[model samples]
Target chain A: MIGIVDHGMGNLMSVRNAFEYIGAEAKVCREPGELAGADLLVLPGVGAFGDCMRNLRHRNFVAALDEMVIGSGIPILGICLGMQAMAKRSFEGGEHEGLGWLDADVVRIRPAGREYRVPHIGWNDVTFEGNNPLFADLPADPVFYFVHSYHVQCRNSGDLAATCDYGGTVTAAVRKGNIFGTQFHPEKSQDQGLRILENFVRQGGQC
Target chain B: MLKKRLIPKLQMKKSRFGNRMVLVTTVRFDEVMEIGDPVSQAKIYQAQAADELVFLDLDASVENREPVTDYIRRAAEELFMPLTAGGGVKTLDHFRMLLENGADKVSINTAAVENPELITRAYEAFGAQCVVVAIDYRQDADGREKVWIRGGRTGTGLDPAEWAEKAERLGAGEILLTSIDRDGTREGLDLETTRRVADAVTIPVITSGGCGLACHFSEGFLTGKADAVSAGTYFCFKDENPMQTRSQIRNAGIPIRIQT
Candidate 1:
């Protein structure tokens, strides 16, 4: 079972519906106690980094998340801001500490030129980096929906999974052992994104 | 690099005293034309491989919030593409409700002009990416473009380019710039104003109101420099669907998502 952790942020329905659309049994697990029975965990968010961490701790989800992700080593996937919440720190709206899952930071996208535009809205292509399972069988032209101003900057190069050219090469996806993350939204990315989600569900979070 | 988008604009309204949401279109912001069911039309667009869909609630009155959300929730369930909804969004609760229900972004027109502070507040809460400031304007007899409110009935006397700059400064992620004069005209997009506003702001700009020929879509990107171009009547009244239009745009050397 894929349990979508509800940290009180973003569009959870789209994510849940995307999973259900692909014939996967997924539930929006709202309660922290409900996290034990799931084979895989999906952290989805679209709000501020600080608020997401606060919500997880306030809703008593941090301890449950630590138990599952660290103790039992359950496969986990984070989307958009949920990916940033896995980082060590973020400099958006002031400095804030993150969940420390990956050695990374969330910072504003400073385009090389003023004409490059911020927020990086709309569909952009991402090229898979390593032999990660997340890119299994995706189309050669893989484009996903992106709408974020802050992007993930990974400290460790080994965690990089995919990248997209904005003003420069922006980290689009990352994977570290059982932890997987995508800066762009697979739920909103249509067929290519659905294929990636299916890959995430099929693999055991291993490269 | 982000690919240019080709979005279908669905002008939706509930039938008088009825619960069904009917998809409608506008010509120069005056004559109203009924299209079809919004949900069914959305499916066609999804099948046609549209990049995204925009739902504009014409009757965005406070009394109509309930039915408006019902239609949004229904459409969001059937379509997995990114949906940006707008019309009469006044407060932060509206943003929360739409996002919770499934809208990836919400556009504000009169509400943003009436209360510019709401843009900053919505940004502080939901982040700038979800907050879209919809700017509708009309060119006068003297070739001056001023912002229009209340479905283009009332005039704000504000310059579209200047207002776009203020909107971006106030934390809006994108600008949905619509030219009331060219809406449904089929002549072409208002490249003059589209270029002005697109150059004024550093954020992405979506130019609406004048997409007729296949070349118009490419013009909006190449000449107008808009990040995206949207058309309602052109797609509704004409045989040009998103796939055909996307090929035309891509053939003109614009990097848009390939048709699946």
Candidate 2:
């Protein structure tokens, strides 16, 4: 079973629906105790980085999440703002501390010397950097829906798994061992997105 | 790279069956023509790998009712692509209701005009990326672009270019510019007006109405400078789907997503 951590931030139903569509038993886990029965976890969020962090801490999910993802070594996936929360800190509204699971920082995407717009909305191609189980059985450079102004900047290049170009190289996906994060919303990316969620569920059992 | 988008606009109305929502095609925001069921059509679009889907509740504004949240939830369950729901969104609560019901984005037209602060408020609550301001406009006898509200029933006397610029400054992530003149005419998009609004705003602009052929989509991207093109009549009236439309646009030398 997969437990989607719902900390009162973004739409958790969409993520849960996607998992159900792929024939996986996924439940919206709103409390820390709900994480005990699940072997796989998903942290899904939207809205500002600071607000999401505040809500997570308010719901007391930080410690439970760390225990499940780090202490237990359970495979986890973060989507969009949830992915950014894996970083050390963010500069969205102001400097706010993150989970620091991945050695990265979140900052606004600044397209240098171009007419590229912020909040890089709509569908864009994501070029895979290395072979990862998250993108297994997917076509080369599949398109995903992106809606954000800030992206993760990984301090360690080895953690970077994929990227999408928007005037500059924007961090699209990252993975470190059992921990995975994708800046795009797989639940909103259609067939390509369903394939991604299916791969994550399948790989979680192996981990 | 972010490729240009080909969007299929689906209008929703209370079905004659009484409780369900059915797909309706409108000409200049009136003269509705029933197409089919919204949920089934949305599934077909999802299978075709449509870039995004727009669901506008046609009766919401005219009937003075809230958007069909039930219909939106039904469609979102079967769709994986981004969904934008609009029509009769007047308050921040309305925006919240739609977002909570699986709408990835909410398009505001009537309310945003009556209260410009609604756009900013929605943007503040949900990030700018979630707020889409739909501006329905037509040229007056003097050839000046005037903004239309209440589903093009009344004119706001605001220029489309100026209103678009203000909308961007107010934190609208995208602008859905629909041309009332060419809407349902099946001639082509009003490239000149689309260009005017697209040039005024830095954010992505989606041009709607007056799309008869796939070439009109290309023209909207190439000549009109629109970031995306939305069509309703062309896709519903003709025996075509978004896949074939995308292929035609791709063959016209415009880059579009062809999901394998």
Candidate 3:
């Protein structure tokens, strides 16, 4: 069973449903005990970075998640703001500390020039960087839906699994051992997103 | 790089902006008893490759107009896509509550027109990108188009083109313009009205109402000049599924990229 951590951000049901849609037995759990029963864990969010961190801490999920990914070696996936929270720090609403699992920082993607919008909303292609089980079955550059202002910039380029050009090359997906994160919503990405989830489940969620 | 979206609008209710002639009301949400749950509805839409999930609290005003902040919170808790909540939002407090709950975007309709300053205030509070001005329009007696609020139940003296420009100036990041005349009719879009607004503003425009078939989406994009097209009736799960319509549009070379 895959355990989806219920942090108080949006996009919980869709992730759960997507798992169910792919025939994966997934459950939404806020309890750490639930983590022990699951082979894999999924963390999803769709709001501000600061609020997501606070909610994770408030629910006592920070330590539980850390244990699940680092201590217990359980495979984990983070989506959108969930991905941002995995970085070392975020500058969303002032500087806030992140999970520090990956040596990265979440910063706003300002339009360098021209008329690129702030919140890069809509569909964009994801170009694969290296061989990863998470993107199995999908095209190397499939268009996935994205909506966000702040994006994660990995300190070590080796951690990036994929990159999508929004204003420029933005980190779209990252994988470090058993821990993986996607900046876009696979639940909302249609077949490509669904296929990625299916691969994540099939790989038994390993590093 | 932000790729432009091709949205299909779905109306949850009938046209209330006096464009009753061109409208065709269908199985409303309340009437669809078999529909399991709102959260489930969002999940299904997501599974169907819906880029984003938008839920308009259609009955909020008729029953008791409170911000659907709880619904937004609950939906966000379940949905993986960026969620947008509309309907019965009247004040900055409502917008703030919706944001606090989990809405990525707060759509304002009657409230913004009822108190025009609400536009500026919303922009001030949440930044321009977070604000979307949802305008419903129908032609008046003199053949001059007029803007409607309160789910097209109330009409404001402001013209839609003027309102679109004003909204941009007031710091609105996007516009969701629906045509009361073509709503539920499935005939097509209110091309002239939608085009006027889209041409008047520099911000992206999402056209809603009167999407009967796949070609309607094309018309909205090519003729209406909208950045996105949103439809409710055409995309509902009741009788006709939306995936078919989406493919038809894509097959016609509309450049719509699905999840796969």
User: DockQ of candidate 2?
Assistant: 0.70
What's the best-to-worst order under TM-score? Answer: 2, 1, 3
Per-residue lDDT tens digits for candidate 3, residues B153-219, read 6678789999989988887878888777776677888888888898888677889877877788878
User: What is the C-alpha lDDT profile of model 1 across B133-182, one tens digit per residue?
Assistant: 99999988788999998888788999999999999999998999999999
What lDDT is obtained when candidate 1 is compared to the true structure? Answer: 0.88
Model 1 superposed RMSD (Cα): 1.7
Candidate 3 Cα misplacement greater than 4 A, ranges: A31-36, A111-115, A203-207, B1-6, B13-59, B62-85, B89-108, B112-133, B139-145, B159-174, B184-188, B191-204, B211-216, B223-225, B232-253, B258-260
The superposed Cα distance between candidate 1 and the true structure at residue B117, in angstroms, equals: 0.7
For each candidate, what is the lDDT?
0.88, 0.88, 0.73
Candidate 1 lDDT, A1-207, residue by residue in tens: 899999888889999989989888898988887776788889999878888888888899888888888888898999999998989999988999888889999998887987788889989988888799888888776889898889889999999999998888888999998899999999998888898889888854332
Model 3 lDDT per residue over A24-116, tens place: 999988766676778888988776677777878898888888877899888888988888889999998699999999999999887564345
TM-score of each candidate structure, all chains considered together:
0.97, 0.97, 0.75
The model with the greater DockQ, 2 or 3, is: 2
Q: Determine which window of 10 residues in candidate 1 chain A has minimal summed lDDT.
A: A198-207
Error of 1 at A123 (Å): 1.1
Docking class of 3: acceptable
Regions of model 2 farther than 4 Å from truth: none
